[model samples]
Target: MSKRKKSTTAFKKANKFIPGGVNSPARAFSAVEMDPIFIEKGEGAYLYDIDGNQYLEYVNSWGPMILGYNPPQVIEELEKQLQLGTSFGAPTEVETEIAELITEFYPAVDKVRMVNSGTEATMSAIRLARGYTGRDKIVKLEGCYHGHGDSLLVDAGSGLATLGIKGSPGVTENTARETIVAPYNDQKAVAEIFNKYGSEIAGIILEPVTGNMGVIAPQRGYLEFLREITYKNGSLLIFDEVMTGFRLSRGGAQELYAIEPDLSTFGKIIGGGMPVGAYAGKKEIMDYVAPLGPVYQAGTLSGNPMAMQAGLTTLKALKKEDVYLELEKKGQKLEAGIKKNIEELNFPAYFNRVGSMFTLFFTDKEVQNYQDVKECDLDLFAAYFKEMINQGIYLPPSQFEANFISLALTDSDLDKTITANYKALNKLKAEL
Candidate 1:
C-alpha cells in the first residue's frame, strides 16, 4: 500500500485548527471512513499526496479541472492577470468579457452576475427569483444540493448525505417550511407541491443533471414537465448548473437538453478551477438584481481579475470545435471498460454516465433518484473505494458523489484504470 504517514500527520495537525480537519466537509473522506489525503500538488490528471504517492485522479477537484489541473494556457493567463492584481473590489473589463462569453454560450442567459462560489450564485439567484415573481416559498429537489445557504440546507445531499445528517440543526424551521422539498425525477411530486402552493412558491430550483446524488440524469420529459408546470404556475424555473456547466457541454445541460430555464447558476469549470460562480437569466428577470432592481446581492471579490481571466481562458479553450467531442470519447471508453469489468465479475452494480461525468453505484437496480441511490450498498462502495485508492486511483470519497473525467487523461491512463478496477472487483469478491 502507498504510505500515507505524512497525510495522516497533516490531518491531525489540521484538526487542531480547522473543523474536522477540512475546510469543506466533502473533503473529510468521512463517508469512506478514512482520513483525508493531503494533496501536495496536482499535474495534469495526477495528484501527488504529501507522502509522495501519485494517484490518477478522477475527482478532478470535485468537477472543476475539466481541462485538468493548471493547464498551460489558463495558468499563463492567470499569471498575466496576477501580475496586474488579484482583487479590486471594483468593476473590471474582464468581468464583462467573461459575462459576454457566458451569455453567448448559454443563450438563455442575457445577463449574468459573478460571485465567489456556487453557493452565492444559487442563493443570489433565488433571491432574484423571489423579487421578480413577488413570491415567498421556493421548491427544491431532495438530494439535489445547491449550497449551504440557510434556505437550501433542508434535505440536501452531498456532504449532508455522506455524514448521515437529515438536515442541519441551525437551519430555522420557518426557513425549512419556505423551502419545499421534492424527489428528483418525480414530476408528479413536483406537480403536487406546486398545486398546493403555486402562488406562494417564488420558483423551483434543481440540478438539470444532478451530480450531488451520483450524477443522476433527469428522466426523459422530466425537464419539459418542470418547464410546463413552472410556466403554468407563473413561477420561474431555475437550473443550478454548478456541476454541469461547461463540463457537460459548452452550453451545459440546458443546451444538451434544449430546455430554457428562467434562471441558471454556474460554477466549477467556469472558474477554471478557481473559486468563482455566476447566476444568470433572461434580461428582463436579471434586471431584478441589485442596482437594476430591488433584490440585493453583492460580493467584493465577485469579479476578481484573476478569476475572470482564468474563466475566460478556460471558456475560450472549451470553445474549440473538438473539446466536447474529445471528452465524450474519453467518457465512452471509461464507461465501456467499467461495464465490461462489471459484466465479467457479475457484480451487482449500476453505472450511470452523462458525457464525462459518471458514477458507479453498488446496487443491482437502476438509480433514478436520491431514494434509489440511498439503497446502494455503501459498505461495498467503501471497500471498493479503499481498494481503488490502494491501487493509486483516486475517486470521490462519497458514494453519493459523481466522478469527473478530464481532457488530461490519456488512453493509457484509461487502460490502467480499467485494470485497477478489475483488480479491485476481484479483491472485493475475494474478501466477501
Candidate 2:
C-alpha cells in the first residue's frame, strides 16, 4: 500500500479540463467525500492505483468486468480484430454474430440494433416505441436509471441520487411532461398510471432487477404484472436490462424471471467492457426502427468490430462454463459472511443482493424502493467507504450504486474481504 499523492496530483490536473475531474458523475467520488483514485491497471480481481496501492476491486468497472479486467479470452479476440481494423462505418460479420448470439438466448429479442451506449439504446427504444404505438407518453419508475436519455432521466437513480440532482438542466419541460414517473415495487401505482394513461403510453420502461438503486430485486409476481398489464393496455413493456443482462443469467433478467418484454435494452457485459449498447425486441416491433420503418437512429461506431469481438468472445466463454453458478456461489458466500458479521456485531445495516450484484445499505429497514433507500445514513456510508479503501478494498464510491462480484475473485480474496468487512463493522461500531 502507498499514499495517493500521485492520484491527488492527477485529479487536480484533470479538474482543469474535465468536469469534476471524471468522465462520468459516478466516478467523481463526491458521495464518498474524497477525491477519486486513478487506476493504473486492472488484472484479474485486483486494481492497481497510480499511487502504487493494490485494491481487491469490487466495482468491476460498474458491472462490465464480470470476467475480471483483461481476461485472456476477450483480449485475444480483441487483438485478432485489432489487426484487421477498428471501425469501418459499414456492416461487419462480427456484429451479426454477436446479435445472433443474443437472439438465441432471449426470445423477446428476435432482432436488435447496436448503438454507442446504454443511453442511446434506451433513447432509440423509446423513439421506436412511440412510433410503433402512435403514442405520445412513456412510463418510467423511480430509481430505475435507463440512461441519460432526456425522456428517461426524470427520477433516475445512481448518479442523480449520488449527486442529489432531481433531473438535469437543458431537458425541455415538454420532454419531462411526456415521461410519467412511478414508485418502483408498487404494482398498485403502476396499475393506476396505466388505468389513466394506458392508451397514451408508448411503453413502460424499467430495470427488471435494478442495480442503480443498489440492487433492489423485483417483488414476487411484480414483473408478470407489468407484462400482463402492458399487453392488456396496448402499451409496450421495455426492460432496461443494461446492468443485469448477461451478468445475472445467460438470458438476462427476462429469462431469470420468465417474463417477456416487448423491448429490452442492454449494455455493460454485452460490450465486454468496451463502450457498446443495444435495444432489441420481437421482429414485429424492431422493424419499426431505421430503414425498415420511420423512427431513425444512426451511429458511426454503433457496432465497432473490436467491441463485437470482445462481446462475442466473452459471451462464448460464458456459454462454455457454469459461469452463473460460479458467480452465484461467490455471491452467496460473500452475502452470508457479511450477514453473519451484521448479526454478531448487531450492525444497523441492510444488505440487498441479486446474483453477483449487491449493496450494503446503511439503513436498518428493508430497502424495497427509493424512499427506503433514502433512509440510509449517507454520512455513515461515506465513513465506511473510506475505511474499506484504507484497508485495501475498493467499492462503489456511492451508497446508491451496487458493488460487483467477479469470477476472478479467488477464495482468498473472499476471505480477506470478509475479514476486512468484519473489522470495518467492529471498528465503526467502536467509534460510535
Candidate 3:
C-alpha cells in the first residue's frame, strides 16, 4: 500500500472548516472513490498537486480553462487591471467592451447582464423569463443541470407527467413543483407538456449539448424542434451554455446547430478561469430586470474589473481563426485515439465527444440521457480514475462528467494522455 494514496487525513482536517473538504460536491471525488488531491498550482495543460505529483489535466477546471491555466495574455491583462483597481461599484468601460464582444459573437443576444457565477446567470435568466411571460412554471430537460438555483434543484419522479422531487434536501417541495421535467431529445414529450400547461409555462430551458451528463449531444433536428414548439406555445427557450459556450464554437452550441434560443446563459471560457457568468437575450425580455422592469436582480461584484479583464483577454486571444480550427483538429485526433484504445482492450467503455469536451463511460450502452448514464459502472470508473491519477493523467473524478482539453496541450501531450489511458485500462483489468 502506498502512503501517498491515503490523503484522507488532510480531508479529515479540512472538513471542520469546509463542508466535505470541498465547496463543490463533485470535487470531493464522491462518484470516483479517491481522496481529493489538493492542487498546488497549474500552468498550461498541467496541474501540480500538494503531493508533488504533476498531471496532464483533462478536466481543465470543469471547462473554464480554455487557454489552460495561467495563459500569458490573460495574466498580463490581469496584472494591468490589478494595478488600476479591483471592484468599483461604479461602471467601467471594460464591462461594456466585454459585453460588446460577447454580443458580436451571439447575433441573437441584444443585451447581456453580467453576474458572479453560472448559478447567478441561470437563476436571473429564469426570473426574467417568468416575469416576461407572467407565468409560474418552467420546463427543464432531465439531467440538464443549470445550476443550484432553487427552481432548478429538481429530480424526475415516477411518470412522464409526474411532478418532480426536491433533488437536494434543503430545496422545498414548492420550489420543486415550479419546475417541470421532460426527457431530452423527446420532442413529443415536450409538446405534450406544453399542450397540458401551455398558458402557465414561462419557458423551456436546456443545455443544447449536455456536458453535465457526459457530453450528450442533441439529436439531429432536436434543437430546431425545441425552438419551434416553444414559439408555438408562447414560451421562451433558454440555452444553458455554461459548458459549451466558447468551447464548442466562438458563438457556442447555437452556432453549431444553427438554432437560436431566446435567452442563453454563459460561463466557463468567458472568464478565462476567473469567476464570471452572464445571461443575454432579446432586449424586450432582458429589460424586465431592475432599473427597467419589475423582476429584481443585483450584484455588488458583478462585472468586477478582474473578471472583465481576464475574460476580454481570453476572448481576444481566441479570436485568432487558427486557434479554433486547431482545437477541433486536436479534439478529433484525441477522440479517435481513445476509441481505438477502447476497442483494443475489449473494454466495455463508450466514448462521446464534441469539440474539446469528451467523456468515457464505463458501460457498453450508448449514453444519451440521465437514465442511460445511470447504468454506468461507477465502480469501474473509480478504479480507472485511480489508475489514471497514478499514471499522471488527471480526468474528471466522476463517471457522469465531461473532460475538457485546452489549447495549451500539444500533440506530444495528447499522445502522452492516450498512452496513460491505455496503461490505466490495463492496470484496471488486471485488478478485476
Model 1 lDDT at residue 170: 92
lDDT of 3: 0.86
What CA RMSD would candidate 2 show? 0.8
Q: What lDDT does the true structure give each of the candidates? A: 0.93, 0.93, 0.86
Q: For candidate 1, give the lDDT.
A: 0.93
Give one digit per residue, the lDDT tens place, for model 3 in 1-432. 123543566788888899778887768776666678888899999998766778899989999898989999899989999999988998999999999999999988999999999989999999999999999899998877888888986753111111123376778888888899998888889989988999999999988998877888999889999999889888999999988998899999999999989999998788888899999999998888899989999999999999989999999988897887999989998998889998998888999988888889889989877788778887898899988887888888877678998999999999998888888887777776
**TM-score of each prediction:** 0.99, 0.99, 0.96
Residue 413 local lDDT, model 2? 97
TM-score of predicted model 1?
0.99
lDDT at 90, model 3: 87
lDDT per residue for candidate 1 within 1-432, as digits (tens), equals 568999999999999999999999999988888999999999999999989999999999998899888799999998898888888888999999999999999989999999999999999999998889899999999999999999998888899999988889899898888999999999889989988999898999999999998989999999999999999999999999999999899999999999999999999888998999999999999988889889999888898888888889999999999999999999999999999999999988899999999999999899999999999999999999999999999999999899999999999999999999999998897777
Cα-based RMSD of candidate 1: 0.8
